[model samples]
Target chain A: MPLFSLKKNNVHQTGSGITPIVFSHGFGCDQNMWRFVAPAFEKDFKTVLFDHVGAGGSDLSAYDSVKYGSLDGYADDVVEMGRELDWREVIFVGHSVSAMIGVLASQRAPGMFSKLVLVGPSPRYIDDEGYFGGFTAQQIEELLEGLADNHMGWSAAMAPAIMGNPDRPELAAELTNSFCRTDPAIARAFARTTFMSDNRADLPNVVADTLILQCADDIIASERVGEYVREHIPGSRIVYLKASGHCPNLSAPDEVVRAIRSFV
Target chain B: MKSSGPSVPLSDGGEPNAPAEDLEDLYENAPCGYFSLSSEGLIVKVNQTFCRWTGFSKDELVGRRLRDLLNVGGRIFYETHFAPLLRMQGFFNEVALDVMTAAGEKLPVLANASERRAQNGDVLFTRVTIFPAAERRRYERELADARAAADARNRDLTERWVAEREQGELREQFIAVLGHDLRNPLAAIDAGVRLVLREQPGERIATVARLIQGSTLRMSGLINNLLDFARGRLGGGMAVQLDVSKPLKPTLQQAIDEIRAVVPERVLQMHLEVDVPVAVDHARIAQLFSNLLGNAITHGDPLEPVNVDVATRAGQLTISVANSGPPISPAAMETLFQPFYRGEGKASQQGLGLGLYIASEIAKAHGGRIDVVSHANETCFTFVMPIV
Candidate 1:
């Protein structure tokens, strides 16, 4: 199938700008994660929302392990989506792991994207010597083991912490629902790909104007990780949000919108 | 209070007007845990029953979210599924979760929540009821283990069955090799008999040589049938090497003459007319013709002539064997060409019952077909091959 149909790409044109802002979700969820944030840019930009292969309403048969083993595969999908849709001046908005995917895509097709907005971006999730990427290899292994044994249990336990709204249980509930709806095998494969990936070297190759939105108390992607991303990418700016979780798009959509609006 | 089985009576002496303080006591001491959360999921109010169930004080539980009382997994479930469902559908029911106490002990529970809406249609708060469900969760774990055990057993049984079938196939192929090896010894024995008969022994000794020769021929036929059956079953059907350069009529006639030598008492008739060279496997055709002729002689009436017909027309070669006999029953005809199928007949009149099956398989290997027609007056088996 064509990339547009295979990816379940949905286009909503409401703005006058020649550039289209495309929203790509991270590993654990789908395009629905951008429900609150994508609409904020509809009036000023041509907004695009799509599920990656094997997530949401995408063609699950299109997901081949070899094709999606690395961040490069997802980057290729973004570039192919542009070519299939005949789209230009693309403004890519990527969340979590998708931020590095966008960077890789922009490097491959530099003239395709005009700007990039990265939300809770993490180039390397595993911590190494002299660098703190928030998680240790052992911790991620435990997380993966928990997922393998009882995915529902893992989702229930981690969604609230990830959402950072223990006072408002609805936010945590939304995250868990998203996690449960995904295919378990695909979710496991994507989790390994997202957490194990190290895209630090590819960050300097990005030519697009990039905005990194970092949350205040994101345990998944720490403040140090955000700073690492900003330092590596040339001519990029970082805006810190008061929202105290990983998914500011769901927890605090207003702050995420404000950050993107000021940069664009 | 006098008649109510040692229970205390109402303070107002059966009056409908109970004090608000008394009603508050009933609400706090309810049998199950009861709590309410604001639309934002903050714990607006919780009864004493709920506080005691979770082993937390009122001060610690009141302002916190209901999800905060549960364990990590329960908190995730509350936030992801429970909260979203309450907001969207206005109610959620009987969701299983584990509540963690102050000392980190788990209490399994099933919770039901309903949204409280104001007149303006906005959600004011959510009321949740919790019930213990330890026994049900334990039962579910047992059921899961049982299913896993059954699946493992099924896999083991399937592997054993496959291994047994492979061993059986190896045994059958071994028998086929054994039958093939016996052929050389039998041929040697037949040659020795012929040489001794050439010496012109006395009449009494000559009779023994003739009987030995007859037994050897019969044994050889049985071995050939066994070998063919085994080859067909083990080596993916009978292997036929086609030699298009060979003439079909002469090859078939030669096979007919050999069958005539075997059954000299049966009157044989042949009508061979072939104007063109037909492409075929000559040795396999000879085997097929020999099997068909042998079948007709064994089953046909000795008083009637067994007919052999071969003709080539319109790029097709048709060979048929017809003999007079009782019409084959529908029951017998269905399995007539199947291997090891012996219909009701005299035991003395039986061969291996593999002759027709081998003939059919050989025909198929040459991309040809065999058809049989049985009637009161005649039974005919016809082989049709395209002259490619």
Candidate 2:
């Protein structure tokens, strides 16, 4: 198969520099989530952006339940894309669940990625014995239920009227009909996979120099989780940003860009 | 909740003072709950209705984030979809959420929120309004359940229908194969009987060979009818090759002779008045004539003569067979040409009931039809087709 048809993940390449900087978006959105941050490095680095299998412009038909049931399947795609693009000493910037996905990909292809930038990363989501991953099992189940409700036409029905914000023409143009539209069933499965994953064991196996951009007041991945990630990954350091949400790329893109620039 | 209005001056100038209304009381006691959250999502201020609805006082509700008041599901929604959308669009409307009360009860509500930004476009605070929606949620759940049940029933019915149709096709295919296989053995018996009769043996043996020959001929007709019925039912209709070069009168006579030989006691009269050539499949027409003649012999009065008429006139060819018998019942007439309908109380007949049905199918394939008329005096079946 041709490169684009192989994964059908809507991979886009830009920037003049030769060293590729791949940006993987987190859950709840697609590569459009990196609009504000990814462009900042276009002049200095070769920027690459893509959607996951079931989100945004990615081919939903390529989403196999068994393959995407675990985060490893997503990591395989990342590894395959890296090899297809023929990138060596690559810079990978991942947000939220994609952060862990990047970690897994780095481990699978040992020195393929030279620098790993994990923003609001969480190695595990559910709290285990002697581990405060921030959420309980029951809460994760509730989250799944919430996802079902969101996709059951409740939010979708209201999105059109709400998105007609005349005051923000830029937002209207940037959103292009849907901000974070995803296949309902795929989103539910992806949520279960993301929240139920335990990649703490995989953290120590990272060979590349890693940086964790921990945001303040992030409920999804707490400050403690960031510190735990730093301790596990050898020679990895954490940079605390003043931004207060799980998506600092959207909220505080400048700070995210600055942190990534200094690291890469 | 006192109304505030300026009293209109009466014509006689009686009362002028109006009652004053407190704005704070109206804001606090509104029908819907209202709250304002700081840019960080903390509750900076809340109305009395919201506090009362949640069973929390103003002191207890202050300085807490809005997500803290929501249930686990609502919190996750707020963090993942709600907050990100609000950050991007600056507003969201009619979002369904379940709020956790101080007493641990869940209050389902439809909430709407809009961000308030300063002159420089920096965020100040967000205003939120919520309405209780327990009844609406219950109705939606019931609708979803009904829809799901209907979908499952439709899927089940479609699957069963497909399975039944497949089984029917398979049965017809089996019948076609069986009919084809029965022919070879039947032909062998027919050939053996003919050979035995030609030897001019003893009278007893000659009579037995003739009986065997009649039985084999009847069996062959039954198998041919069965194969035709199977093919027609399995979507390949009766195929006919209309031949205008050969006259059709001889084929009809041959069919009558075969039927007469099978039942020599019954009298059959054939009237052929054909001067023009009729385009028709010879073998198929012969089969049709044989079927009608056989049916007449079995069902007609044994003493009465069965009449077979064939003629070409007025650009049409008509072949009809008539017999004197008891009138066919109205109920049986409705299904007279249907396959496997061997007439009620006539189950003891010596052939499968597919004869008339195959006859009708052959007639239809030739752009023709068979019409039946039954009365106390006589019952007649007419096959008619245009010469063209």
Candidate 3:
């Protein structure tokens, strides 16, 4: 494959520092999700940002249904990307489901990532026996149906124009105005995978020094879920933020930057 | 600024003097639900309309987070997509959500939210409006289903088209190989027949050998036509090698002579007026002429003389063959050059119906075309090409 074709992941890197800080975005959005926080560390670290295969300016054709059928496939990409960039002692910061993806990647390649910061992380979304994951099975199904309903409007209005200019920077900039615009089919699949995955069994195996940023009023991953993650992972610490939504990165970027700075 | 109409009474704050009770009434029972939430999403203020729609009193709704009234899925969407967008973009419009009413039923609504920021860039509160969308949601669901069905159908058609194209290419390749393989045996049989004829075998044996030779010649013509048809269908078209040094008169005469030997009783009148060193593919031209002559001999009235006109003038070459017979029907004329198209009521045993198609293809390869004219007395086929 050509070098540009690997831009299917749209990996972006900056800074002159030796320690690489790779930022992975959540389920519903792309790497632009980190715009408010990642730049804060650029002067002190080699800040890296990337979109997952099906999001943002990433090449949509690289999306394979079978490969992305589970979250493990996504973790494989992170590990592969680390190997490709030849980074050592990496600091991986992931938001939402990507937090769990970072955990999986660190476990897959034990010493590659040295530190992890999970913001509003949830090991599971659907509540299981003796555990409240913040949702029921039927409610997740309803969310999938709601996604289908909105996709009808979204694809009809935006897909053709966005698909026509995949490589245009102006188009990419325009897309950031909407922020969380994702291909509806890929969004639906990611939703099912993120909400349905059970990563509770994998948390205890994490060897990296981990920090969980728990935001108040985060309905997607509540404070209790964040605490649950901290309790399961050895040597992991949890900090409760005054910010109110799941995305403190956008709502309280200064607070998020402070939390990551103190930990790193 | 001056008021054009009667001056309205001003309040102490310089606002329009409307009835305070009416203003309160409008706020209490507006058509759509309206409310405001603190930056933390706790319901800071509420209208009676929103309270009534959710089956909750103002006292019950106030101070509760707006997400508490939503179902689990709606709550997740609010946190993940809606809240973040509202914070980053300052507004979100026409987002579909289901509010869990006090009666434990889902109320589908289209919600719009905008954030109010203070001068210091601190978010003071978020105002929201909600419209009942049960009917519209149902219609949207139907449209979504239809779009999904259309996408599936399009994918299926593309897959089938690719498979069909592959199968067609394989079939053409098979035909070309079959045509090539059959030639070696055919040449051997022709040579054997010629040796037998030269030895002057006994009369009955000689006659049988002559019949075999004729059959082999016809078979070879059929194979050549099959190969050309396959090549044309496979997108190579016809390949012609132009030889300017070779005289064209002998090639034209040879095609006529071959046709005459096949049908000795049919009368043919030839006219050739080419003397220039014409740049042309001699064998391909002869093949085209032979096909036209064979068609005329098979269809024309045997007693009538078939006219052959070959001439080069004005930097153009024109070869026309005219035969006297019954006029061709207009229906047959439309499909005359199409492959496997034989005339109506014609016996299938005469040929494979590819001769005219191959002849026309050869004409096209030479950057030329064949034209036809049929009248009450005669049907004519003409080949026209540039003499470059």
Candidate 4:
């Protein structure tokens, strides 16, 4: 297996009686983001964590622009991670933008994951003429400008705006710090790819039991996207967390854990 | 969703002279189907689109009214609502309507309609445009079905909860009375043993023996009452109707004699105020009298007088049993006649709650209802029934 040393993305094996749970991190962050949730699962579950190519400790040489640009490529990595570890019917929990990609991944490889726990994911960006996406064209252009101007400063300023609220002001800095830690070029490329994509049609064929736990106060991925996700996924359930940050697992991990535990 | 309607021809049953440019447009697409109707309600004119909708030709329907083309049920619905709305609204727009084609399949539509007004502002013709509503109609059906199912489930849950609450109350009351009912006979048995051991004098001996017999009878009667109550629950007496020609006095006498024997020393008296006879179930009448006597004995204060009266009028007989006792509180009176409903705060009383309940059920089965009125020193329970 070419000694698949993915930096801190090392694939360790521990098979307990409890069904395995896998975690996928969103753009601008790595599997370390799920550090709080991973340990809670360590005792009971065979927990697997991996990095998307070009992000986290993933090899910069292994980055392929054409394949990495599509969500299906990361989904492949998730399934391959499960196959390599030899876990069956595992619970795949994904955070932030990687949430919806988890659903698409499950649809691509049938029966690879038992159920999907999507924390925050938007199916489509650049809302159509009739639809209202919280952001205007000017705002998205400003975000791109913020990225181009002082990439680090943009991460600092935009993080609080997208990830946290005044009530949970600490989350703004924490998520921004998480974003600033990422490679700037890789983060910018992932942002462009996610914002430009549309997956409205693909949601219907999603047959996995879906739990969409939307943060009540995420500005970037607002509550309406949560509603759209629920409406598109047939027989899917959705609950709004009272927490006020984009990364709720970090801000209120107990509440997030309670929701996942209650549903499962 | 598009409806195939009739075609248009000129009056006197001839096709109109085609204007070359209008003819060209007609062959391609005109939103409304052209149809002419005779004064007698026959369709005279139709266009290609109307022909496609109704699956009929201009030649076939040159003399049929718009009503004749509609399905039987659709015709009634159109005349009742659609026609009036169209006339009053003056070209109704987006009217939700359903129509049947020649294939007898339903098509949902949003119809925008206008009448071809003449110079005098009277409608000589009508034009309608139908757009398909397949997706919207399907969604509406699903929404309605979900709401209806939820409502039905709620109603069922409410009924089940009420029944469960009633059952629980009945169980508590039944358990409380089970002790006293069984103890009465046991006490009588002890008294019989004491009398036999003591070898008392002649007068003492007879009284003690009568007490033992009366107490044992009350105990056995309680057991029998319990059995009848079980039968009544399964609608045991509904199949049996009262023999209207039967006499009522003997049955009342039998019940009074039995209760009188139970408490020989107590002054329980009967007063027949009316000599008229009644048409009723004799066995149930005996049961009613027996239950009334027991209720008076258990609920009335010690040494108070219990009085029974029977009266009759034109077609109904009214029987009243009054006892000088602790007045039944108003709250207790409300559910007094209910099964297992002893008076409020009277759960400790020494009577099976089933007595009054069984008596009332019997009354109802005999085509009557019974009620009670009470004051501090006087409580009267009355049973009224039609003679016929």
Ranking by DockQ: 2, 3, 1, 4
For every model shown, the clashing-pair count is 5, 0, 0, 23
Q: Give candidate 4's error at residue B368 in angstroms.
A: 99
Q: B1-388, model 4: which lDDT tens digit per residue?
A: 1224344422343445644344434642566555554323355555677667656666666665554554443343343234433333234454444555677666655555555555654456666565666576667557656866998999999999999988965764574467446767677786765667477657877677767766665665565566556555534543344665667777888878777876766677787755565667777778777888878877776597788888788778888888887788877777777665655436656655677887787778778888888887898899988877
lDDT of 4 by residue, A36-104 (tens): 567666767777776777765567676667776877766766666655655566788888667767877
lDDT of 2 at B339: 84
lDDT of 2 at A193: 90
* Cα distance off (Å), candidate 2, residue A118: 3.7
What residue runs in model 3 are displaced by over 4 Å at the alpha carbon? A1-6, A127-132, A152-178, A223-235, A240-244, B1-22, B302-305
Candidate 2 chain B minimal-lDDT segment of 10 residues: B1-10
Give TM per candidate: 0.60, 0.84, 0.88, 0.36
Predicted candidate 2 versus true structure: per-residue lDDT over B135-187, tens digit per residue: 87777667766876999999999999999999999989999999999999999
lDDT of 3 by residue, B1-388 (tens): 1102343433345335655334455656789898888876778777878888889887788889878888777777777777766665566677788888889998888887777877666788898998888998899888878888999999999999999999989988998999999999999999999999999999999888887887787788889898999998988878999999999999999888777766778899999999677887988998899889988887888899999999999888999999998988999999999988887546954687899999999999888899999999999999999988
Which candidate leads in lDDT? Answer: 2
User: In model 1, which runs have C-alpha deviations exceeding 4 angstroms?
Assistant: A1-16, A124-180, A195-201, B1-44, B62-99, B105-255, B260-289, B292-356, B360-388
lDDT of 3 by residue, A63-139 (tens): 99888888998999998888788767799999999999999999999889999999999999989999999888999
Worst 10 residues of 3 chain B by lDDT: B1-10
- What lDDT tens digits, residue by residue, belong to model 1 across residues A1-264? 454653443333455555688898876557767777888887777788877777766777778888788888888888888887666768899988889999999888868898999998998988898889877787677445434433333334333333432334444454445533556567768778888999989988888999999988666788999999999999999999987656777667888988998988
Error of 3 at A75 (Å): 2.5
What is the C-alpha lDDT profile of model 1 across B1-388, one tens digit per residue? 0111333333545546754335556657788888887766678777788888878887788777676676543443344344534543356555667777888898877777777777765567888888877787677557656876898999999999999999979977987999989999999999998998999999988878877776677678778878888877786577778787777778987777666655667789999999888778887788888888888888888899999999999888889999998888999999999988785667898887888888898899888999999999899999998888
The CAPRI classification for model 1 reads as: incorrect
